[model samples]
Target chain A: MKLTDTFKTAIIGLKTNKTRSALTMLGIVIGIAAVITMNSIGAGAQNLILSRVASMGSNNIFIEPGPWSKRMEKGSMMQSMVEEANITSLKREDAIAIANHPLIEMAAPFTMGVGRIVYLDVDKKSSYSGITPDGQKINENNVILGRDINEDEVKSMAKVVVLGFTLKEDLFGEEDPIGKIIRIQKTNFRVIGVMEEQGVQMFQNMDTYAFIPITTTQKLLLGTDHVKWIIAKAWDEDRIDEIVSDLRLLLRERHSIYNPSGDLAKDDFKIMTQKETADILTSVTGVLTMFLSSVAGIALVVGGIGIMNIMLVSVNERTREIGLRKAVGARKKDILNQFLMEAVTLTFLGGVIGILLGLTFSYLGGVILGNMLDLKWSAPLSLDSILLSAGVAIVIGLVFGIYPARKAAELSPIEALRYE
Target chain B: MAKTTEVIEVRDVRKEYRNGAIKTDVLQGISLKVFEGDFLAIMGPSGSGKSTLMHIMGFLDRPTSGSCNFRGKHIDSLSDDELARIRNKKMGFVFQMFNLLARTSVLDNVRLPLFYSGLKGKEELELAKRAIELVGLTDRSHHLPNQLSGGEKQRVAIARAIVNNPEVIFADEPTGNLDSKSGQQIMDVLQKLNNQGHTIVLVTHEKYTAEMAKKMILIKDGKIVYNQKVDHRRFAKDGFEK
Candidate 1:
């Protein structure tokens, strides 16, 4: 039999019962749609996070004062992630050394503490970070009023502060408050600048902060010689790994750690470049996408079973028709091909509809999610996903359609004709 | 005298059905020859195996023992697919229930056999039209089966049967579901086709219907009680009354 003829016959059979055919296709439609939606949303989320990370200047690296435990070398990969050392060994000298490197643009040693600041009668509690003018520049914190603290202030251990926009609003309120005296931790300090309006960056709320010189913060507020963390900006994008290795060697030599081998666990500090952070975030979202996609794959399997169930019912219902066809000289393969083609056509059509629906839904979903999360969503639907879904739909049809088609083909004409 | 060609021949064919070891012999040691251009009817009461015998002869069922041959080929020796090919090219069937596909137009229903005959669309359409014209359903060729009358539906079945221009036609209780007027019209159509030189094996319970055929057999309890030529045949005359 010609494939076209068999296809026509299959179409006729399906058209005879349109409601059932559509209902049977719904399962496949939903399955493919779910898979595509999951993939699209995953891509959109990855884009949002990666874009956010890139906005923080790709050359920046964050250094935290935490040494890995000696057990890291013998432990699993995940176990080596534990790196909260109790000893505060990171000093301001380490930041200065790192800042002097040829590849380093600037290294800002920063320490933070929460203190009550009394300006006139307003006694407000706020978090303050002690960093230099270089730290303010690298973080994109532009001083809109007055002047930023210079390197001379750090050498003189000057007790001066810069107020963030929201903090200035809370403390001074519509008044030009630069050069005004504020009490922090029972010590008097003059506000040198008011920074421009800055919101959250890298999960840190930047608007409600007050800044002081790192030496003044270490000597007066908490009375410690150690700095908490340092932010390092590279001179250029290339050879970041070399700079990181050099920083590790320099720190190891200064701190007198005797290990010659470069083990990250033995280092006194943990450094993560913005790219590494973005990569980790991407891998995490990738796992989530894969997990959700597997769930959608289950839906496809269930849809295949739905096709099988409906095909079996159709075979039972059309016993007499099958007998009549056989009597009229339909070979077993002809009958099988007819029924199988019916199923494949159904799923393939459903796959097309599903791809369109999935794309539309994902586009809408990206917009909705972007509005809710306050981030720009740029998830582009990929051709690989479309082709993958189309192929899956056809395969499900063949896998599920085979049994029922075989049953119809193997029917004895006499028995089928006589079937009531 | 010219010798007749045996289109189908059976030698002591037995068809038994086993229901959990309880055997029922539907056709018991039956032997027969169907000649080309022959209109033969096997008439019997219900459960007398007339339909089973016709089915065996028509290659619809296999015998439990003995041999049945069609066109010098043993029925048991041919594969099901090979038999299906033969049936498609050389055989046609008309059932009493008028098994036309529901929701399909008369033309497509008639064209079904040709669909499997591997004919091109144009040829299939032309042959189906000719078959429908022969069955006198040309006017109703585009009508769905549900829209057709009982008599018209039977005519559509006849059209489907002869669409492939088979060498032989099998009619099992062709008029059993129709009124007497429609039955007379159907018998007339069959007789006209027989006259035009199509070998026919018909199954019927009605004695009057059997008499219209050139040869008749009476099957009683899985065995042929008697076989003879019809002496008086009734034709579907104008305003014919039974």
Candidate 2:
């Protein structure tokens, strides 16, 4: 028998018991849909995170004052929170020493502290950052309303401050905040400018921060000279490796570490490039996607077993029909092909429906996730996902349908005709 | 004396069935011969092993210990696929149950054999239509089996049996499910096909039905009791006698 006829006969067989056929294929439909849906949503989420990481400038590197612990391997927010109290290893002198290199753009020593800001009658607790002009440049911040604090201010130990876009709004409420006096830690400081609106950077909401000169933050607020971390920008993107190694050697020489073994575990400070941060985050999302996909894989196995069960039952139900075909000159191969084709056709159709359902579900998931997280996300349907789902569906049918088809082919015609 | 061409030769054919430790011999050393263009009937009561004999002779079942030959090809040496090939090219079968695929139209039901015969779609359809015309079911060609009368269903089965133009047609109790009127019509159709020079083998318990065939064999308890030409061979259209 030709493949076309076998498929046609299978279709007719399925049509005869429409409800049974539909129910039999339902397991496959749900399985494939789940697989595709999970993968699509996973891919969308990975893309969103990678893009956010990319938004943190690609040529930037972070130098934090810690003894390079595994828990604080990268410059995640936890590093700064733990590094702030007594780690006096990083300072303005370190940034000054690193910024002298030809590959170096500028390094800014920075610190974070929370305090109540009082501007006339309005007052609220907010976090503040100590930044240099170079820090503002690396942060991609442009003072939209007024002038930014300059390098002379840092040398003069100026009390001038730059207010974040949201902080300015909350403190003044549409009032002109530039050159206005705001009290922090019971000391009056003039708001030099209102920084431009920035949503999220390095997983921190930058809109909620107020910036002060690093020296002023060290001398006045905390009465300490220790800085939490340093931010460095590289002039050349291609030579970031050489710049990182050069800074390591310079920082070690400045700190006067005598050991020349070059062991990272013995280092007093940890340095992380943007690439390492991006790679860690990418691997995290990759593992998450793989875990979810394996869970979906269980559904496919259950669905394939469902096909096998139904095919077995169908073989039993049509015993006499098989017998008649055999008596009428059907080869065992012909019978086997007919039944296997039926199963494969059923799953292929289910895969198509599943792809459609998965795409729809993933698009809706992306929209919902976007609304909740306030991020711009798109769920894309790639050729790889479609082809993978379709191919798996075909393989599932073949793997599950072979036993039943072979059983039908091996039946004795006389006994089958005599079957009830 | 002119010797006829023997289409089938069964010498000491035996068939047995085993259930657990119990053995039942269905066909015990049964020997028979069928010539080209012969209309043969094997008749017996229920469980007398006549059906088993017919099955063995039709190549649907293999004898346990015997030499069963068709056109000088030994059944013992032939593989299952080889047997299927011979069945597709040289044999046709009509069951008592009519065995038409449900939800299938009459034309396609007749085309079942040719599908396995490897004919192209158009040629299979053409041959099916011709066979349906021969069986006088041309008008009902597109009607499903559920809509057909008992006699018409049997005629559809006959058309299917002859659709591939086989050398022999095997009918196993074809009239068992039909009324006397319908049974007579089926016998008439079988006799007419035999007259057209196709060999026919019929299995029936009814003496009147078996009388329509040119030869009869009676089997009792796995052994043949008699094989001879029909003395008063009856015609189906003359009104069957009990």
Candidate 3:
């Protein structure tokens, strides 16, 4: 039979029973939709996380003390200094040493203190970060409206503060706050600059916090010589690990601590590399997306089964038709192609509709999740998701469609016509 | 008899049916020959195996024993593909119920055989259209089978049967489902085709219908009781008197 005529007949047969055709296609539609939606949402979450991490800095390594290293070093159930040695040993001197290392470009000592800001008629609780001028470069903090504090400000112990972008909007409204005075606890400091908006990073919003010189903050606001933590940057991408190791040795010597030096097996402070963090993020996101897409793939399998089942039923219902076609000289291949084309058409239509629906769902879902997470919602749909889902649907159709088509084609014309 | 005019030949054709473990014989060593341009009819009571015999003759069923040849080719030994090719290109069929694909247009019903004949191009479509027009259904070509009258549906079936210009056309009780007027019209078309040198084999229980053919074969209990040529004047006057 002519291919066009065969297609026409198949189409007419499907269209004759519109509801049955739609019900048959429903499984495929749901499967494609679920697959595409899961993949898109997973990709969106991954993109969001990577941007959050990138905003922090690719060269920056976070040194968080780990429990395993502390336990290995102390070998005790309860020890006070062991835990403190593990965490608090990451101090301002280590930051300066890392900064001065041959492989290091820049680093900053920073301490964070929390206090209520009171001005005229407004009072709000906010984080106050004490940082050197170099911290600005490491954190990518840009002054949107006012100047940032200079190195001279830190050296002279200037009693000046820089407001984060959001904090300025909250405390000063439209008014210029660069020269205004804001009270931190009992000490009032002059605002030197309003830092640019840095959205939100990890758990802190740089836009909401105010920056002051580390020395002045240590003496006046925090009331101790100790700095909260140190943030460091690498001069070159290749020398990050070498600089970190050298900085650790220098800090150990300067502190007169007798902890093993190259003993990550019994380390005092933990150092996590940038590549490690990136790998962890990629692996976690990959695993999450795979898991979600597998569930969607299951739906596609069930949909394929649905199509197979419906086609089998159609073969039964159209037994007489099959017989008639065979009698009129339809070859087995022609019969097979007719039914296979029907199956593919059903799935292809379903896939088209599902992609559109999935894109819509992803957009809405991203907005809802973003609002709940308090982050910017930008879940752009991936074209790969649409194409992949379509490809999957077609494959599913072909795989599940073959058996029933073969059954129909293998029927004997006389027996089929004679079927009661 | 012309040596080159034989259209169908059967020799020692035997058929059997199985109902679970028990077997029953349907056709017992039957043999027949049909010449081109002849109108032959097989008539029998129910359970005489006339339908089975017709099926074997029409190539719809293979005989259990012996061979049937179409245009001197041993059809009994041919593969299903080869058999289908033979059926598509060499033979046409008409059923008692008209067997037009319901909900399909008259033109499409007529064009079905040509579609299977592997004949492409506008020429094939025009041929199909001409066949429908020959059946006086040019105006009703677009109407579906259900929308056609009994006589019109029969005409459409005739058109379909002749569209491929096959060597033989098989009609099983062509008039069995139609009223007398429509049945006569159908028989007239079949007779006209026979006169135009197209061989036709019709199966029927009605003597009046069988009388329309040039030769009549009667079967009883899966056996041919009588096979004879009828005089045209006598057949026109009163058909078989039983």
Best by DockQ: 1
**What lDDT does the true structure give each of the candidates?**
0.87, 0.87, 0.79
**Order of candidate numbers by DockQ, starting with the best:** 1, 2, 3
lDDT string, candidate 3, B3-95, tens digits: 647888888888899999999898887788999887889999877888888778777779889889888888656888777777777788888
DockQ value of candidate 1: 0.81
Per-residue lDDT for A218-275 in model 2, tens only? 8888787878888888999899998888888888888887658877767778788888
Off by over 4 Å in 1: A52-61, A68-89, A110-131, A136-228, A234-238, A256-263, B238-242
Per-model DockQ against the true two-chain complex: 0.81, 0.76, 0.59
Rank candidates, TM-score, best first.
Answer: 2, 3, 1
Once fitted onto the true fold, the runs of candidate 3 whose alpha carbons sit more than 4 angstroms away are A55-57, A67-86, A111-116, A125-128, A150-160, A183-190, A202-204, A214-229, A248-265, A366-384, B1-4, B232-242
CA error at residue B77 for candidate 1, angstroms: 3.0
User: With candidate 3 superimposed using the best TM-score fit, by how many Å does residue A1's alpha carbon deviate from the native?
Assistant: 2.7
lDDT score of residue A69 within candidate 1? 52
Q: Is candidate 1 or candidate 2 better by TM-score?
A: 2
Q: Order the candidate numbers by lDDT, best to worst.
A: 1, 2, 3
lDDT of 3 by residue, A207-249 (tens): 8898999888878887776665566777676777776677667
Residues A298-323, model 1: lDDT tens digits: 99889889999999999999999999
Q: What value does the lDDT take at residue A46 in candidate 2?
A: 80
**Root-mean-square deviation per candidate:** 4.1, 2.9, 4.4
| Candidate 3 structure, TM-score to reference | 0.89
